[model samples]
Target: MSDHRSESSRPARVPEPADPPGTAGARTPEPVPAGVQMSKQSGTPGAAVPEPPKVPAYARQPHPRQPPSPWGPAGRQPSSDLMKIRPAAPGVIPAATLWSVLATALLGALLLGDGIGLNLFLVAVPAALAAYFAAQAAGRRLRPWTAVWAVGGLSLLAVPALRDAGWPVFLAVVSAVAVGSLALHGSRGWLGIFLGSLGLLTSVAGSLGWGAHGVRDRMADSRGRWGVAFRSTVAAVVLLIVFGALFASADAAFADVLGSLIPDVSLGEGPWRLFLGVIGLVGALAAAYTAAAPVRWDALTVPPGPARGRLEWALPLIVLNLLFAGFLAIQLTVLLGGYDKVMAETRLSYAQYAREGFWQLLWATVLTLLVIALALRWAPRGGARDRTLVRSVLGTLCLLTLVVVASALRRLDLYVDAYGLTRLRISVAAVELWLGVVLLLIMAAGVFGAKMLPRGVAVSAAVGVLAFGLASPDGLIAEQNVQRYRDDHSIDIQYLRGLSADAVPALDTLPEPLRSCALDEIQRTLRGSDAPWYATSWGEARARDILGDWDPGARVRNCQELGSGDQGNERGGDGTGGPGGDDSYDPYDPY
Candidate 1:
């Protein structure tokens, strides 16, 4: 009874109030930290608790900033609108571009009727000048290096005015002009140059659409006077045609005067001139568009390939270098010391020995260059040691390959001396020499750097080709054969006969029958109706002058006899008539 009375005396236990409306179950109970105790009202009674864990300073710091995503917010794909190609700003075509197009069309109409000669130079130079002015009018600053390519292209275009060989010079001129167009903007690296040249085709096609758009915009503008001018010009043309036809039909004198004043548009010549004019107009528009907004080829950078492991990269190159060194050592021994003894032991004549391996060496030199390029592309870029190894191995390989180039050239020289100079022989020798120059450039790049090597190589090739055209390859071939004939009376009359008018002066130095035989075809071509001044070349003019005072009738009989004797010898001389017993070989065959 006393215990019960004490319990009741303990402040009659007060009941807790209920939670307010809308408050019950609204909040989740807070999570207790590890080793932290909860109140008795929230947890089981009499539960044991421990100390809380320690927090590190780094964990308490704020998070660092993150890079923005390439996609839209929350990682969605980009919007389609962003990916679409925007149309060019609405504006009329520049007046300078229009003037340029008109000038180009006029030049084409006047000059293209004649064949390619001074016409090529006149057409090409004016077009280039027009493009420059158009670029300036478009407010674009010309690149400094543009002049180099322009000069190179213009100089090449002048080849037709000088040389008579048709195909090679034509190809060189086309390549130079294309590369020059690309340079009006700018490019970097080999890939940029290649793609930029290719892009010119697309630029030309796109210009049609671009010009159409510009015309539409011009027509839509109310303030433009072009529409009025167009209508008035059409009306004037229609009225003039009606009145002129009436007056021409009324009187014979008026008809003759009208016929003289207006050019007769023949079915053949009229369409060709129109087509040429259209081509010129299209080309001018393309040039102007490109100058206004060129593709940024230099901005397109290629990421480097994966870096290679040191051993994986170095071992193969080292082996290649050693192989080249071994081959070069043998070449040096044979070239410098025992050339005659080796030839005697091999039982081969000088020409046979020279011809047998010269091509192989040339191909090897070319392949070695490709290998060096690939090595540089995949080379390790980690440390100084890797750089050193690259320089030593590749540099040594280049040096050895250069010696191979020398050997190849020496062999070609020996072959030419034994036989005679042909277009094929001279062209290949020039290519091999240019390849040697490329190797020297590579070695210099190794010592310095490779940043400019690609452009340098391209520029050198252009210079080489230009020099080749200007040097007059066919002329040189004829001169060499003439000198050879003087040295030893061995002459290939048939080969000289096949050459163009550029060889006329050289062939004129020969005696009567030989000169008559060689100049027969060329003289016939020149003696035809003379071309206009715009269509004449220096070589053709010179040929006319040289043959002006000469007569072919006196030597015709001797030429026939000489030709019959050569045919007799070819058929009866042990069946091994031509040089090196290769009777089927054509001197003009590039291969």
Candidate 2:
């Protein structure tokens, strides 16, 4: 207390010695949080200021959000003018664009038609874009010279293709460009643009090659980027015309294939009309799907969702689609008035057909929709809603199951027709097959995908294509598609069971029926060869040496020679196993 009194009796406040540097007399605001109030003025004695605390590392420094204006007036505020008064063009697409497009479109042109070829050519667009994006990602621009080089490379490849006018060459060149661009710039955007232009060029080339381009003489057409658009229009028109001409010319071709089977007047005309009709329907279906669904075309994929164990969420959409497809098929037939009946006794046209089943389908659809509305209404809240979703979905599934079961119970024939997911139409079947495979792929791509199922499915599909009918043990039916493809003209499998010399040797080693078939194949194949594969000399040598003739001492009689049993090493009937110790792998034998 005495010390405090002594200090309080001090005369005046001591001032620190100045003159290290004279004060600038500038007022400094105390460091504070942004919105804190500051004192109005300093006291008579200079206000005491606390030493500023060290800033924490986690504190963020303020910065301008955007770049400074470029077109600012001097000493005045700059305007946010990223845009110039004018922009320049990239210049005329080089001649190489034509070559690239022609190259790309050649395959579809030869195999399908110019219309289909044009669609294939669009593949180049993404390829080009891929290269551009890649280069951009690597912190580089695709210079004009690079574009020139890429185009030039594509052009160089086309010289041979143009000379040959073959799709093989075209495919090679465009693919080269696409792949080369991806390799060089890593999927640049320019790759897409360049490829698109090239595809258009190719489409035009395809049209010309197919003898259709000259038909567009009425329009002013220039070849380049615009050439694609021009060619697309010309190709569409020409294809339509060409189809018309072919239909008129080949009455026999049309009548033999479709006239008796499909009685619709349009279908009776020719294959072309049928094809176009199918394509148009498919396109309409796709467009309608896009319109109805929230998903974009790019995202036309099945994504991972709630576990399949909780099937309630998934079944509704699935049933809806199935019913919709059925509804559409019936509705289309009715709307098109495609049905016609031939007289039973007279074998002549009887009555004009009106379509059936649309009204019933409509009523059922309305009922299903009402059920869905009711389900969504009283569902649980938040994530628990998923569980509540259980009821409606199960209900819908039960309803659908009942329908399928009821249809089954009504009549065996009707049940097969109703419940069979595979539609009768060729187009529908193809679509179904494609969708099935895609669905498999999607499931494979999921987190807890159908692993065991995918492997078996993939193997079976491969076996189907690889074995075809030729791989069958019976030799009468194909291992996979059997006679289905032959009747339908949908699949062609001439090259299945392509065994090498290292694999199964000659035909006779195989079990019967197959042995005869393989022998037949050998005979047919070796017919024209300088050194025939199944010639008597080669056959004998192959049978004697590679086939190992027979085991010790079972008298082997030959189909070719009776006493030649002495020439071929014979096998004894000591049937414990083979001479090599164990050759018996009988599929029928149980352990």
lDDT of 2 by residue, 31-102 (tens): 444323334356624544444344454453475345446676555665432232111211222233333333
In model 2, the worst 10-residue window by lDDT is 563-572
Top-scoring candidate (TM-score): 1
Put down candidate 1 lDDT per residue, 1-591, tens digits, no spaces.
232233422233456456667767654444354334444443533333333455555655699445557555864544643233222432346655666667787678767776778777776665676567656766767666667767776777777887767755686767666666666555667766766666556568767776777766666875458867778888998999999999999999999877755544456788788888888778777766666666666655567778798899889988887887898787667656544754655666555666678889989999999899888889899999989988988888898899899999987876676567778888899999999999999999999898988778878888888888888888998998888677655566777788888899899998867888889878888877356666777888888888985667766565545532333211112223223333333333443
TM-scores, all models, native as reference? 0.74, 0.22
Off by over 4 Å in 1: 1-91, 215-267, 336-339, 549-551, 554-591
| lDDT for predicted candidate 1 compared with the true structure | 0.71
Q: What is the C-alpha lDDT of each candidate?
A: 0.71, 0.33
- What are the runs in model 2 whose C-alpha is more than 4 Å off? 1-93, 100-384, 387-508, 511-517, 529-591
For residue 98, what is the lDDT in candidate 1?
66
For all candidates, the clash counts are 0, 27
